[model samples]
Target: MKHKTLVLSAAVGLLAPVMAGCGDSGDGSDSGSAIVVGTTDHFTATKPNPAPFDPAFAYDTGSWNVLRQTLQTLTHVPRGGGVPVPEAASHCAFSNGNLTYSCTLRAGLKFANGDTLTAADVKYSLQRVLSIHDLNGAVGLLTNIADMDTSGRDIVFHLKSPDATFPYKLATPIAGIVNPKQYAPKKLRDGFEVDGSGPYTFKAEVKDNTLVKGTFTKNPTYKGDLKVQNNKVEMRVYPDAPAMGTALDKDDIDVMLRSMTPDQIKSLTDKPRKDINLTEMPGLEIRYIGFNTSAPIGKEKAIRQAMAYVVDRDKLINQVYGTTASPLYSNIPAGITGHTNSFFNQYGAQPSLSKAAQVLQSAGIHTPVKLTMNYTTDHYGAATAKEFQVLQSQFNDSKLFDVTIKGTPWKEFRPAETSGKYAVYGMGWFPDFPDPDSYVAPFFDKDNFLGSPYNNPQIRGQLIPKSRREADRGAASDTFGQIQDIVADDVPILPLWQGKQYVAARTDITGVEWAVDSSANYSLWELGKGTTTD
Candidate 1:
């Protein structure tokens, strides 16, 4: 119910390890070597998954790394989950109980073409995503904004509903303000035609601009948390993780662009060359199992609860992740406020087969009940495939039931899960903000449950509104605790594990702070090939 879609395993884009080169000082700039990086992206991934180049379309972390550098958001979170600072807007104001919001523009906020970032740009930018109408997960988020009016450097947003969380939504790259004049009104605009205001502007694009570089400016107007580090950044997109790892080992690249699986992390650690280094940060991402509430299995709360009992999360985390990640019972990822281990508290201490069987029998579901599980292949990783298989084994191992596992690519998987074509699928949530409301809202609210999965009244009716109305995020902990209990009782989806953001960098690149998992913006601001004197 948490809008988690199960995608299939993809064989594409995984990278192979590469050898290293010591003397490739990146054009001999103050930042030292040009930091080469690798990702599991094709040289050009135009269709199916939204391309990163287009500001309006991309959801992948790989795309955000490039977008964050090229296009600026209105506000940003610092290295950790700190208060957001201004980027496009120097400061913003919200009146009328968090609905009518306004932002004062920075004096010199201008696009690469030197066009000022005017109020009209902000209005158009916000409207464009709504107009396009296809940016996944954005429609519900933007449901608050009634209209956006821009006059000169002043931008105003009128909300359809009163929401304190709106500003945080504005900070997301999907809601990123752009030079509205360049992006067309009603279609997914990605590629050479797109434009933005950030530290970098697209200087050159090859392989459909999958390989892009952003020129850095003083960005005097950019007073946000995302600071500009190097003068320029060149992003090279590889097809998959293995190749990205290969490139890093060979020194063909500077840092591994994104997080890798436990095994991949191990290979980099065990086979570490002098040049390669590992930077393991607590990630803000959470992955879970979402049952299609629209489906018959979801109709029975007992069946969903049974699924949770049978699947061994500890085994999944330790065996599949190899100590790289921690198993989680709560939808909230670790490190974020309001995180609770509801699953462990309820089931971890004693995974009783007898208890699980008894619970099912009491509910009139006899032994040998069957269910199907699904996943998205390329969306997560090879580890995701193994994860689903583990679930299948977990349930089938229980002589009380039968489990079937299947998956599709992310592109197909999103729609399939949304349509309730599958009974259950592997689902993951990378928060838009670290707030408890974000975790509570997306899955349980009827509108947020895009795939027609499970929804609970405590979460949707009472808990959601109560959480949102509060000015202090931490104030809603009691309600959130109730929401968790409701979820456990409903048993719509089983909580799996919380993930950490893992990136193996060459020793030279330092000051690299991976933004919180929810932001997904890997700006080159805090990054340098090594040290910089300038």
Candidate 2:
């Protein structure tokens, strides 16, 4: 969780509007011209993309048209991250007081392969989420769907109980529809091969996760909703931020899709601040820590609480991450539902080792307790190294925990956590949907728990279900409040800080939405070069 994060923008940028790559429309593709978007990873292609391009395997929002594009839910998510609207489904009729929801699918909808997008495909996709739990990220979103049935293109959901908020859930990528034919039932995807009915097709995948775009002139096309500016797009990946900035300076890249720290941006902005456009949106991302209950050192709630207190969150934010991050007390963060001071309401400022020592001493605990902290080095950038160093000092200085720090790269980091390799771990969430459910569900729940396996019945059984049942968000506050309260008590995971995101682009790029910390690529479909649009 450097400690944890999420972003947009406009301006008089450099790179001088190129006729390269068929011009920029939001399809996330570069035409025959091959737009050179630079990421730190050098995302140059070494292999072709893999197909079935599923979101269920890994919660990859970065993929276009494959999972997210081919499928449309009964509803649509809004810009502010609230409610949903009818999408693939023309309309919905909720019976049994919103518990039993029925929907009518839009006519003429079909997959890229020409398979009619049907109620069965929707049923297969949602049920498949529960059927495939080992895939890591797909289990949480489907935990609520009790059962599915089809009547023509209309599918009805029979919930275990009445839940009004289920409609909003259909908008997430986790619940996205996929063709049952191509992908093997339990297999997970490791590359960019995709086939979908979205605005673009998965043409090619380059090295380091850069995606090549193919035309979307197929069934269930969305050409009417999008303005096709370019025929192909290229995503370039770099290993780190400095490398990304270098690419921008060399004009090897057009837009730096996300922002760095204020200082980092100021360097380029001040030199001729007018030359580069820096756009920022605050209060979107949530960063948190789950003390491994599964770990011998992290088993004690008192120790987790102590670490949460002892480590200075504000200092970590200012020094390690610069001004780009905002400290948060709750998992829901700010600008979203279920916001709370529950963490701070329980523990104030920093933790007092004196108090921590007493908690441990009363528990008859031993001092110099050996603790291991794990982090992903390359994934989080320089901020991660700084965060690890700061925490190492904090724990060692506590005189309570004898600590060992482990740093691994993302490739290893991804599986190690799921397999339960670390005592205390770092995790950052990029929300799958705008709703509070997306963040809350992924980390908690008894059966669907992500890691460190913190289970509270009040949450998994009662509170979460009640919240899901309430159509009105305000009515659902008490449920989330209870969830936060229990989180304070269990201390399985510590709340860290929410981050601010910035995207730097040349002055000519346009149509970029500047707000939304949910998913970086969700609205990129609307992004364009040279002009702005709604």
Candidate 3:
């Protein structure tokens, strides 16, 4: 999963496209003037490092949102929900029993800067990300590639194991092809310009080394599967959700997405805006509490289980998120296949002081378990402080635990969480793709994205590998279910609630429903003024 400021999650093993949803007019028509899209998602990039647009380093939604329009992958997740379809590549398939993945580059592929985008460039782009292994980069998801070779127009990957999910990984921004000449092979390329072969080529504006805005215009050199529907897309970064909502209300921006405060959502839902078209879609984003299992207090399974019993997901959703989100019982949120209410199945639907006490008493642990919960201050939203406050209230009210709350900025909070500095911390996950594996593998694997010491040998060694080998992703549901059950029993990460995507665009805006897909990949090419027929 690519980390959003809030965290990110994944989907299927099959290469076949699984189509769902409808909105866009498939015609390649550019009918709209440049439109501004606003969001609260931050564009973070430190100096002397790969810029957020550099796919090799960026692992966040704000950066990927820009990269999606500028870079073309071998394959792409469809406009609706489905498996990867050919983008830069004309065709792609597996051989050697799903261990070898090969793709032939589309004829006459060229970057926006007029550089030839050959298979060699694609090979270099993927390899460089692995070699650099930036801490914030997505090298963990791509560790399966044992070796790769470029033959003429074809790029072949030799996976170390039978991984059917490899193709899905290829569809993500992490696998976005970059020009070898412009991008460094051993380190991140510093600068603002990007040489990509997607529907649009972008020039980003950086203020004090942070991405302020990105202007995307149609690339005549682009020869990919997607057709540009809008002439230009200008993505503007806003300070907060209220500011973004104000921009949407004042018509300063044509579209508002990524995040809106629950108060804003409740207000708009209660009194619909005449000029705004609010479209709600099933979201794959989830929020949860992760424990540092290596920590002294966190190492106790009873404490984790007791905390799970005391957690009130309903109250958290109702008080904090309103109707914008639903209570989540598993890491795999609803809408994705193989999702289960594992936490609810184990801990029941509501918080129970009796159950919390019973669990601790049964484990021979002392009453009033001492614990601390941590959360990010600026990463998620202003509402995050209130959300954690609610969590603290729940924990303290249970009378079975004494909980301390700590809030830190994202930059400081991320390092502390990874270094096992926090006992339990809140996190949000947006999917990398629409697969169950994205939810399970990233959190449960030996080298899990979270530095939590939750390495279950059964899950890491047996269940995940077996599930990845199954070509028919539907058949792997049982394995994913088993994995979720194990996670629920172990109480490594406690699932809290799942979010719903709310996009507010002008009435004349076409293809708003198709703009953000299940995996939250913003398809700027699908957004246009009025209807395509006009």
TM agreement with the true structure for every prediction: 0.85, 0.84, 0.91
Count residue pairs with overlapping backbones in model 3: 8
**Minimal lDDT window, size 10, model 1:** 3-12
**In candidate 2, what are the lDDT values of residues 79-111, reduced to their tens digit?**
433346676778876788776888887887777
lDDT (0-100) at residue 119 of candidate 1?
A: 72
Model 1 lDDT per residue over 186-248, tens place: 777645444677766655456554553333343444434455666555556555677667777
lDDT of 2: 0.61
Off by over 4 Å in 1: 1-33, 41-56, 190-193, 203-225, 267-273, 514-520, 531-534
The superposed Cα distance between candidate 3 and the true structure at residue 415, in angstroms, equals 2.7
How much is the lDDT of residue 391 in candidate 3? Answer: 92
Ranking by TM-score: 3, 1, 2
Candidate 3 lDDT (Cα, 0 to 1): 0.80
Clash totals for all candidate models: 38, 33, 8
Cα deviation at 140, candidate 2, in Å, is 2.2
